[model samples]
Target: MTDFDATAYLPDDLLERIRSRAAAVDAENRFPTEDLAELTAAGYLSILVPTALGGAGLGLAEAAVLQQRLAGAAPATALAINMHLVWTGVAKVMSDRGIDDLRFVQTGAVAGEVFAFGISEAGNDLVLFGSDTQAVPAADGSYSFTGTKIFTSLGPVWTQLGLHGLDTTDPADPKMVYAFVQRTDAVETRDDWDTVGMRGTQSRTTVLNGAVAPADRVVRRVAPGPNPDPIVFGIFSVFEVLLASVYTGVARRALDLAVAAAKTRTSKKTGRPYSDDPDIRWRVAEMALAYDGLLPQVAAIAHDVDVLVDHGGQWFPRLSGLKHRAVVAAKQIVDDAMLVAGGSSYFQRNELSRLYRDVLAGMFHPSDPESAHATVAAAWLGPVGG
Candidate 1:
């Protein structure tokens, strides 16, 4: 029997650390160093490693729950941890291939060190196939990779690197050889990543030049077989869902502040408490309703993922829909919170302002609004048979 219990996987202590310093965490836009340490020490970073390797061996459902909880405390930290979760998931899946990738897994599981994904490129529109990076084969079947991958979150912090590139030597093979190279003397991280939102992510640019990638480090790209796990979409879903939850928590904080302000402030023109004003009461009510509305949808989608994964059906459409819905709802929820909070919400020091900016990143998730809608439509309406 597996030793995975979904309920016990959350990092409560790390959450406490996040809750305690949330204000300061936003105030400085600093990486959540303390929170990362807590996760590492508590084995939260290794949650997806198979139980045989001394990990929690939980599924994507439990992983989403943990991500959501972490984001509820700190969105920036949650974003960075998403990279760790993706690495752990990849390790677990690779382990099932009947080979020993445990060395890599153990390195990350014990030291709290791994890599951010290297896929996106600068000025590249077609992100899926736009891999400017290249990996050429050597005589001994080893590969030398060279290229710069931009917007790599935790690029500077991780001990390894996950990269994708086309093996042009086999043009007709239709497989872009994927590889993970050790972060030794070959890889370099550029001073980039000053973004509008998610500033705390430290998403720098990584340049790989003649990086030696052993045969064991290479994996197939988007393998299409009888059973494709759709792990990428699953990872994207976790990111979108948790980010929505975190922004919702921030909106909740804003609403709480608005309620307090309404009760205490007496409008000079009306000569009464703001809360007594119909307009003020209406705003508060609207904000509350929006927040309440989003929670159930997010929860229901997460539950569906759990149920589907348990019963064994590919949940591509469902996961895509959940990501789209939750992120869109979070945008609406935060907008309402800002509306109710009024001019005070604009202050940089105000948590709501930071959260408003942070939540916007949800729209750019891999399974974004447009793609997600298309996935659902294709599934429900079927193809045109063209």
Candidate 2:
């Protein structure tokens, strides 16, 4: 963890520029187009693609480090990019485990194509395992997906949408189809990304009215409900780890802001800076402690994924718990930062206020509080029915 240099890829100057635009991007409720353009130019889109495929060939752990740095400056922008990384990251995961099925995804990223994750569906709790969308298979092995996908990040410019749908063509056994569809007439992007925070993401709704994935683009056809499919594990593992990275970065930024406030903001009562205030010092220490605790866990798990550490069945719960803790810790750190920074942070224009709003969106993301708890409980205490 100490050896990896996150700023090596996303340098401080570029991040500073992105951070400068975050407020306006959020306030205007638009995608971070400039950030995307800059990141794409920086080869960020192919972070996970193998060097053999003309990418950086970085591992998941390194990617986590980079994401945390990016998120610290501009969380929404990092998150908007997270979707694209998930696909390429999934490809890396599969590749690491000796599967080259999603190799084209890697090359596509290298060819300057943005991939968006479109597996999420409204009211669909069985994420990555099942879907409400329907997949109709053709004689040519192509499949047309007809359903709506919610929270489609990178909505404005994703060239390929990696999505899933339930295929019931085999009446006796239903299989979940995972495929990629290019942006075309069949795909509709609803401009409805107005949100409380993270508006810069513009993770709008995608309505796929029989959008097609050619035989080559059709990746997985695992049966519904907890299958031992590589794609499922790849998506879940990479998704959870990267999500944790982004939120942990948010917490790190808030902690830094609180420390800065403590050193600079003077306290009239004590005739000294807030840093001299014992109460303020204690609060700052607690926030630091909380943020510090999660770093090792996030790094270890991400590295485990990279090296293919066989955690066996405990993988799902471990990943879920990492994301849960990172988010919870980030939200707490931001709240404390606001308190430490005082009234100035309450204003909408302040970065802490923006972070406060941005962190709230974390709770709504997958591996939500309830589901995370359930996953951990079932993993540790055995399934309820057993």
Candidate 3:
């Protein structure tokens, strides 16, 4: 890749501190206080805030590396940071086109403002299929939002939101606007984040009653653009693939822990370490096979994106297939890790338990397994009606 000095953007020591703090934070179901601070101190939270604005100018590749490495340390912390990375990318893209609310991002970056993706709504089994939040225009040249957003990642901690909504009054309209809203202290948050997994993510419901969004605070919500250059697609592909990267890292650690457990425990009947058992070896081998298979696929997808870009053609199907493979591979890897670890994987106190939950999150993300498959099929086969 490019000779980008990522270390200059954020050092290793701080990442360790975040990791160390993450375990405890995950246990307590608390926000990763130290991790966020360390990230801010390293200017990692502002990696895409633009160099002109006194922030790191790292692009999507660097951002993917940061998330993947950090997720290896703490998946919850990494997932929380993923929201910010998304916001940063959104900001950077908007800024490049001069359609962004730089002041909001700039002010938020310095203010340590957390931006939540307020896309999920109550009663929606699927999170990405738009939202029920209504944004109505006012006579005073502003929009008033009235709705509750459910399971908002980093909900209680956010000072800003990348809110997605559509105006239903005009049902025939094909366009929906995404706006950036600044959260005021006056808004209320519910402490109902009781979940089976990713507890520390603090994903909860938020209520906005007549929350006024000013004109300047609104950034046009644009769909993620397909890469024109295959090479650039390779670089950008990292963003989607990194979810798999983080999950793979989590599964790898689970296997590591299992192997350690096997090495110490002796089989009562055999009077030997479990490591000597052929059955245990088989399980471990399976786990290793699963983990080993993921990295190269990601690398190849990245290369394909790069090639497509260099060749000057759309890499949509290639990129979609990459996403599909990444998600499927991640699920298989995590499931294999649990199988290798056995029933102990069910215990919340174990790291494997957390990894299990974090991996499940991937199945529901933007390019989820089914969605990725559909996108790839559509790209290759065209519409079925024709």
Cα RMSD, each candidate: 4.3, 0.8, 4.5
Error of 2 at 298 (Å): 0.9
Models ranked on lDDT: 2, 1, 3
The number of clashing residue pairs in model 1 is 0
lDDT (C-alpha) at residue 37 in model 2: 94
Residue 220 Cα positional deviation in candidate 1, in Å, after optimal superposition: 2.2
Q: Model 3, 91-160: lDDT tens per residue?
A: 6644554544544675577567777767667665333335577777666656667788876777666878
Clashing pairs in 1: none
Model 2: residues with Cα > 4 Å off, grouped in runs? none
The true-versus-predicted C-alpha distance at residue 286 of model 3, in Å, is 3.9
TM-score (C-alpha, index-matched) for candidate 1: 0.80
Give the per-residue Cα lDDT of candidate 3 at 248: 56
TM-score of 3: 0.80
Report the C-alpha lDDT of model 1 over 174-292, residue by residue, as the tens digit.
44556678887788887666666666677788888888888877655543222243444334445455545555555565567678777877889989998898988988887777777
Per-candidate local distance difference test: 0.66, 0.93, 0.64
- TM for every model, in the order presented, reads 0.80, 0.99, 0.80
| Residue pairs in collision within model 3 | 229-309, 230-305, 230-306, 230-308, 230-309, 231-306, 231-309, 234-305
Model 1's alpha-carbon lDDT is 0.66
Deviation in Å, model 1, residue 192 alpha carbon: 1.9
Q: Model 1: residues >4 Å from true position, as ranges?
A: 1-13, 20-29, 93-103, 123-130, 221-314, 380-385
* Prediction 2 global C-alpha lDDT: 0.93
